[model samples]
Target: MWYLRRFLLRQPRSHALCPTSPSSSHAPSSSLPSSPLQCRTLSSTGGAGFYNFPPSAHYDLIVIGSGPAAQKCAIDSVKRGRRVAMIDKNSQMGGVCVHTGTIPSKTFREAVLHLTGYRHQGFYGKSTFTSSRRSSMNEILQRVQKVEDVEAEVTRHQMRRNGVHLVTGTARFLENGANDAHVKLAVLLTDPEQERKGIYKHREASLPKTLLTAEKVMIACGTRPVRQEETVFDGKRVFDSDQLLWGGIDRVPRSFIVVGAGVIGIEYASMINVLPGTNVTIIDPRPNLLGFADREVVDALMYSMRHYGARFVLGEKVGYPALASTSMEQGRRASCHMWGDFEAIPEHSMAAEQGGEVKSVLQQGGFLGRDTERLFPYGIYTIPEISMIGKTEEQLTAEKVPYEVGIANYKELAKGQMLGGMDGFLKLIFSTEDFRILGVHAIGEGATEIVHIGQVVMAAGGSVHYFVDAVFNFPTLAEAYNVAAHNGLKNMGINV
Candidate 1:
């Protein structure tokens, strides 16, 4: 990683990938220079491996998928003056993060919080809002769309201004052309949805596929909620996280069963459970949730969520939807459209023999999957968000690393009290001997933002004393670090 960063810095922008366009597909370019390979291996060099697409169509770096990972890589490459082209199946750019997943879910949470007076309940009560007994699904969706629109536009503009050729279509790897020196891939330029609906912009829509080769291709197509092949997606009763936004959810369901206890599942459970008339029961195969966070923090979050009427059925594995019902149609007829992990909700006390088709849906994805080895942060937006980094106490203990824990509750901080975030808290774990920061965990407002303070210090080899001596503005959540430092040092028998 360090070597790659240094190399990128040394490479001149003139040697960047040449952004391709509609015309480039029709007539490949012949402008590639045969400069010294330097360190440009098949993986790093615009893809001198097996793909055998037209040389003129070759880009310096081809980033597939417009999600965060792809976006960052593309931007970095283009800033170096590389010809970069980014492609996605969605008509609107930004992939799932902006279009259907993160942006929509978080915005939905905010909308639910504001519309139902969830945050304002401390002072004005739930009745502080209008006389509506239940929140309309349309109202929640409006906020999500508005946010997604702005974010997607920003992403597209960011790529365009940086000279990234934006291709709206689906991308697929062709052959492992071992004999070829370039990496070749295929793209369907027509919108996927339009093709599905048999709606064509013109007679040429039916044949929108383009085969282009690149020096290097980055597969950033973020994973979607993987519903089983047999599972039916009526869009109303059954849906994935992406579909959950479009017609993912109709209204705040009276009750929904979330199959996975990963970040997304818990987040959706937390947000929807707070609605006027909604209930959520989250099921996970793991006994403990958020295995990466501090035990105390996860415990607190679970307790709060339970108090809010969200049920957690941990250590329970979901049966296959096929085994639960004789046929897919029968499963859908149960009122709850079956998909993903839920073979049956028998574990949930709220489950009944019949509901025809459950108004609720299943959460079909997680940060970690046994099938893949990708690592990413898990941020669950449950009112007060939860974020963590580095090793947890459990992981360290299992590995026999000595560690200590220090906690600062939001209730004990003036800032938390000021903003009615008494429910929030920060947990800092540092080595016992030197008090060097190990991991920082927080569950409360701006927790996602707070973890970075500890991360920066830890990366710099700073210890607990760094936080204690450092002065933060009074009445700010960042000051929680000060509190954590005081508690940690005090435990170590040091006087303030």
Candidate 2:
């Protein structure tokens, strides 16, 4: 631990790196301020390493991972006149957002809603529903690919135009001490045969190529779907969200059992149910869908989901092979866990008939909400999407902090009503003593986008009254801010 701390302290800091506090000061020698060109050309031959002269390339900043953060860092560095290198392992850049996560998922969701006549066509008939027309996976893939290609091209052109070098490679840290070492990135080259066959493959043809020696390294490697080793993804019945998005809708599972109830799970379940003849059973321990959402919004989501024929298994542990055990405590604890807390369930007990299948368990761990157990289907998207950048109610309770709660139903907002979405809402938790906003939770259409408003308020130590008095555009979803603030003031016995 001491060595690790020393190593971290010794590593070069970038100008773009935000300090934790405004008053915090760094030692002059702690940072290495060098031009990008100088950093790219800098070499250390005398250092102890397998490579004698530490590849001659240098960069003012080296961003590992081509995701949004990395791309932003590279772009910012270039704008600051620093030589930067943005690298990724994939054939194309833009990371998961452009590839599988945000852009593609949202796009697929839009397409699904459109094709299912969810957004419109209510005038045709009360039961007016289009036949489940599944879009071709190839078509969706091509559309995503085309958009990614265009984005990659634009990024590449912009970087080149601004003089930021883009490298394709895998990066690892060359440990010097705890924090005193530099990064080693090996650029992967394509094989001629694979290239000829029209398959994209990264073959280590020669010695690992080093494009840049960086004084600073930023790790922006976005996460991937984490599946259990014991339960192999069959690419059909059992799959991750990324595979679902890229693989196509033709293989839409009938009577599908989604192991998780987080954002991705709920979103997928919602999308699948929009398609005719597809039944989705979301098995999660949380009593409400989008548990991290505002309580009102979560209730609305649950209401919306019921209308879509989505099933939820709440407050119960789900295991494979249909077990008789109702709770996590009843299941036999096994050493070899496949996904989550895998307990053997009796085959006959499962709603879906399957033998020798393991049921994933969600042990209600005290994390976000009280009396809520954490269940199986722990996906990374669950963390960032549902509960990003805020203190949970559990945390606030643990700290014995005094807070005021403000609620706004987006249904009351003109924009939300205009969009035919009554589920959108925002929750603002603030300190009753000082009126400082403590946390913000939102859900529904544009929930993710609008949460930032509260985020800025809380981060800046602003008061709820600030939002109450602030003027918002008419017929906007953002009007929820003013409404929430007004509600909070009313709770405080203040007439606004």
Candidate 3:
């Protein structure tokens, strides 16, 4: 059905409604058509044809890809009474974030932790919990697959409930009209009947086509795993992150060589290291893993992973150019740092190396500096989770910022003993001059969740004194904050 030259016809006005007239600037306001703009049905030979259809649909906004960004945009537009349509190449409604990326990865992590009894390894002997048994790939992936299906269905329901038209196909941009009045898109439509019948099909030259013109177009195509140029990914011998999640391997390998020590690589390494008899070696050209995080927290995480049979090969590039994990802009500006230019924050390259500073600038714009925009927490989900907010000791020393440190080991706390993570601890850094909290770092169970307390405190310019004065729930991991605050105050020669 590629022939699309049926010319103009009238339909209900709501089929193509916009707040303002989009056809022409010279057309009278009253002359704007109150019905669907003329649309063309497709015939077998209409690939090159433009808006040559009978009256059909036109959207105020057309979003490409059904990832979180695209989904939010479409839903928000529909909420504002704007006609919206979303086109995704995949047959599934939600994009990679739902099927292969964040959701699936996190769910897979949970499944692994649960099935392998990783969390309980602290209480029971590691040998008793892990070395005793091995889980099959299908057993672990069953939960991941179920979670993905549910998430995808929920995303589909949300789109349908919100009245956002869902189109299954690949879309390409067409040349815009004069003055860019309307953006035209040519979409290669897939057969819904086949999808309904549960037949996995691929797009073919004979597939139907349609032309859609929108007042606005948004590109939300998600990301893919970076592959080394020299590495050929066969999804068996060597697999990228996407391939790993897409069920490429027959079983968890006895050994894994992850070529990048960034979050993804480290995460997969940690997940695999938890499996019985699995050895994971993480190789990165950069000398550090998660360089954007606090060095102490990262070190603690590395130590924990190492204790669990994971190996690291830093300062050696496998294939790709050694660049900072943060931004390309930061990389270009960081040539001064001979350590392979791994600067996370370009402006304060020496003061802070956390990427959250860049995120703060995007969310809160101004003449932003190191102090105002450098307070956000990041979590690395290794075997023993690590998370931190604000500046590191290295950053403070480089900036000549006077600070005092407070430390609290989880083993000293009843909750920590009960939870069985003895290596976990929370560290607090505060200004020596005013006792204002500068940073919060944690490595242990629930480290990510625990860091938020300090994030809220630092956001309000609260100091270590706040923790000392406030009472925390007894036997809770959160009490570590009070202990750390007191320790910091003690370090500063304050008796209280």
Candidate 4:
């Protein structure tokens, strides 16, 4: 292990590199100090193949991260007989995925699944179980820690095994005055003394200024939880997705307004739903979750979520419009905000959902920043990847329409896991308060085709009982129809 010690001192002058704090510190740059300042360095004894080099070290390649991507890149270069070094400000070897994102989120899912017994919950009629065992935040997090520690250790072992040196400090690029092609910009590492003491500390009292120049630089720095300017993430009551799964959180909230319906949003909402005494309300402007997947898959997911006591506010904003009206002009038919210059034909009427900036009427739709609805200034998509057309449960609920959903999971299907895809579900929403099929929504490996099953049934004016009565091909996600029909019936107080 390379003990990256803290640089105890810096030359008393303005420096170029941005400051590196344990929190919220990005890279900064400044010219090297004219004179050296007192610093400290220390390393644990018995470090295999231990070596120390001043900050003036140069390498063939400098990777500015220690995540899976960085680790692989560094190791590959080393195998090709290239000298490579990796840098990371977070004292841990693994990046955000292992520490916060995928690893912890999946781990949290397992804990919730086991504690809630969600798969078989449908066998019981009610959303809540009086006999259900409740798990504490401490207990759940303790389980997550064991998994995280093992993953981190594996990552550290990989780096050491491959001889990829790790520099634990904030790294930023130095300005290249000459703009030389052979020698790229130098990288400056600003490590605080207190920071070094916490992690692997160096043995020397003074840490040499590290200014590394490399032939090439690769920025493998992964992502962090986005803390938008609109919301105040206090981390106690409010948290970004990353902070919620991290161990720093003290308690699981009794109630929460989880924003977004994307993968993270849906996964978290589902996980939280299984927790005892917890109510989860998911909000998103989209009409449904995993809208592009098969309607059946999404429907199945929604059924599971609702059965677990979760609520969704879909295609609706909580508060405020995107841009308010300054003055209502009689010349235009609708009250709208005009961003581009258009000849306003006097009294021309225009409805919303056309993506036009003008608000023709005082309709109940608008952006509420972070606390309200999502306001997208611009978002672009071009290929024909996947598409769907359906109404959400929120819409049905608001309209006082009677409907039931048949649900299925991709994992339940053998060959259709890809079609039922990972983290995907198939749902059939029908007017089946003993009425016709309403719509099918799905998101899964088999979403595209699975949805067609419900669509065909809906088109034929068949009720969900069709699924209950029919025998589907085995080892197929289509069989989810059987399970979902059973679940829908259970929810409606029907024994069959």
Candidate 5:
């Protein structure tokens, strides 16, 4: 193990994969330069001849996903002077965060807001300033594709800038040879040319494969949607989160039945409900939405969503939809389409969550182990966003902790009125004795951005008094902190 580690450290730090020599037909052309034997190999100089290697590249770290966690792992590892390589199954650079989950969905939401004129309903009146015209699916998706392309390119540039070798392929772990200290992986490489041209046409059996060895392996493979066995997903009539954006429904459906009232379902419902002539119904077995978030915040969100024409069916279960059009035919092979790179949908797709966890491990200089006690914030981007950090009232009650609530509505602020965020509000939960902020929950426009103020204070072990004493900008949503702080202090019998 020591011998192999030494050999890896001794190898040159060139990212160039094996250069295709005129004589060697097996080697493929890569952005990387050539090695001495025209094929890079890992061999131990001072050993009992225990391991003689094939033409395999070596790295100090290899990340399996290109999502946030994988990207952070690769970038952090390189900064620590370790040779890093990242392998993603997607033809594009960024993983689910950029392509399917975060960026695309959020971008779609923005496009919906702008195209539908949903953002100006308060100032212009709903009847008078309604959405002008129904935007074509291609028209709305065009912005999503543009944003995705820019983000993907940014990720690619970041990787190259940090010297993280980026490989576009599906990677599977190979059995560790005689040594357990080193890890081996068989990366099924995608065609570089096809990827460049925004096309992903080949099947797994046809793609080229490469063997890579690394000292440390980080599996940041994101998650895919959990499909119900009873449901037949036709992508058009019925679909999951991924299918919704990627070739599920070409045009926005006049009606949408969203099954789970979780974050993803609620977000989708909110976005789709705003579309002209669209009806969105969200159903869940749980009686309440966002069971983990603050009750008051959840109530506010329900009000806003309901006002916007979203229906909720809670504490009930429904059977799967009847078999829809012929098993949702696979999308056409990738080309220069309006959907851009999002057109090449994989048979199996993944979502996000592990990125932040992996990033925490790296930040604390800690190994991947049990999660630690930390202040984690949750954000749900419904039409009006919901974000919270620390303990909820329900959590505090469950733990039998004594606390008081401080509340501020967005309507009280000029900024909120100006932006038409009448339903938005911020809530603060603090200790009864010392007034230390225990939790913060917000629901409304910029709620995700607003909660960060509370997160920073709570992280620094600050309390509600900080917000009360601080002078925030006069016409900003941030001023709600000041209002809420005063309200909370009043509850605690502290007059200011």
Candidate 6:
């Protein structure tokens, strides 16, 4: 991991992939040029190699993902005059970040909010139909498509203008050789029909299409949803994030019982709750929503969501819907309820208790208070989003690292207030002795976007005093740095 980090952060001194002069009309081909691209490759087995690939020939750098990080790295390499190749199995580029994960989800949230009258509920009551309401699923999807199209075009144009080759395929690394030896890659060209038949069919038709011998390769395949056999989604009733987007918007569940209160789940619940006549219930084992976020921001979000009639069933396990015994025609209403019975599984208890013996007396008749488990058959959402680049509170406690916590409410910032965002807050964890910022946590609107400020400070090995002494622009959300730094200093008994 350390080697990988070093390789990623290290700057190359020469251009290994491109040799064409910036003023030259044609790009330098795969031939030894005046300068070569600098690349460092690291293997899991402590094997490392530094190579300067000649400008002439095939790809010098091959990035195996089309997500934001992958795109950024590829574009940067291209700009440096390297022959870069980016590959993905999906029919479209941009990976999940654009196709399903971030852009599509956010766009859907915006559409839902607009359609549900949340944007102007104070003035329009429940009767008014916002632009999202009149828009069909196709319309909303088109917006996502348009954005992705623009992004894909931009990436393609940049790559082409910079002399990067974009390829579509499934790539797998073969056996490694001696030091400085070239690595083998198996690229499987995907067919639309074979992809429909699934991996088995595709595997049967797989051919050794191309052997890309590159000086460096980046594995940024991203991640996929984890599904258990017991809780497998069946398209109509249960759905994952990817399926939810392609399945259409007309099927929005009347009442959703989200099973997780993580960022993705809560974000979806918040967006769905904004829709008129739609009820959203979030379930999680954590006592507080957004447990990883700053306490103040979590509190504010909880407060805001409560006012919107969003229900939270914390510390609970969600289960499948229970079937009614009575026939539909037998003067009985169709029952649609899912129950999450709180079972004290011994294994889970032991695991939670760190392998310690659990002292529990099981009540007779399948335990008492079982009725507390009620049915709430509903669509569920769950996604795990977390960022940790520095010391956490637990680490500080275990290591006896003295630290002070400083918090700044985004609502207090001029830009935040201008955006009508009152829920987000920034917390800076700083060392009490040196006043260096240890960690920062922010959540609400643009939490991920703003956390980079903290990352920059931490990466630079700077201290909280840097922010406190620095002058931030007026009315900027970044002013939270000043607010938090000052608070940290006060906590440290410093005059500043």
lDDT of 1 by residue, 42-116 (tens): 332432321222233557777766766566667766655567777765557776567655678889888888887
lDDT (0-100) at residue 389 of candidate 1? 65
TM-score of each: 0.74, 0.64, 0.76, 0.54, 0.79, 0.61
Q: Best TM-score goes to which candidate?
A: 5
Candidate no. 6 TM-score: 0.61
Show model 2 residue runs off by greater than 4 Å: 1-61, 79-82, 121-143, 170-185, 192-217, 248-251, 285-296, 315-395
Compose the digit string of candidate 6's lDDT tens values, residues 1-496: 0000000011111111211112121123344343323333334343232122232334666776665555656666665556677766654666555665566776776566555545344455556664444434565566766777787677566656766566655665555445425433555545544445434123423322444556666554444444434554544445545555664335445566666555555666676665555666766766776543445545666667777777878887545334111000000011010000011211011121211111111101122333332211111121111222456566677799999988787777888766555456677889888777788766545555566778778766789989888887787877888898888788767878
lDDT of 3 by residue, 449-494 (tens): 9999999999999989899999888989999999998888887678
Cα RMSD of predicted structure 6? 18.2
lDDT of 2 by residue, 1-496 (tens): 0000000001111111122211111111344334332213223442221122123366656765555555655676666556777666554666655665556765666666655566553335314655435544454455566676787677667666777666544543432335535543333333334434545444333323433456566555454454433444444445566556545334444556666565555656666666666666666665655554345445556666677787777765445334221111111121120211122121111111111111101111112223222111111121112222355565677799987777888668878767655455677787889988877776566665677677677666799989978888787878888898889888889888
> lDDT of each prediction vs. the true structure?
0.61, 0.51, 0.64, 0.51, 0.65, 0.52
Task: Report the number of the highest-lDDT candidate.
Answer: 5
Better lDDT candidate (1, 5): 5
Better of 2 and 5 by TM-score: 5
Better of 2 and 3 by TM-score: 3
lDDT of 1 at 89: 54
Q: Which ten contiguous residues of candidate 6 have the minimum total lDDT?
A: 1-10
Model 6 Cα displacement at 211 (Å)? 6.0
Q: Model 2 Cα displacement at 281 (Å)?
A: 1.4
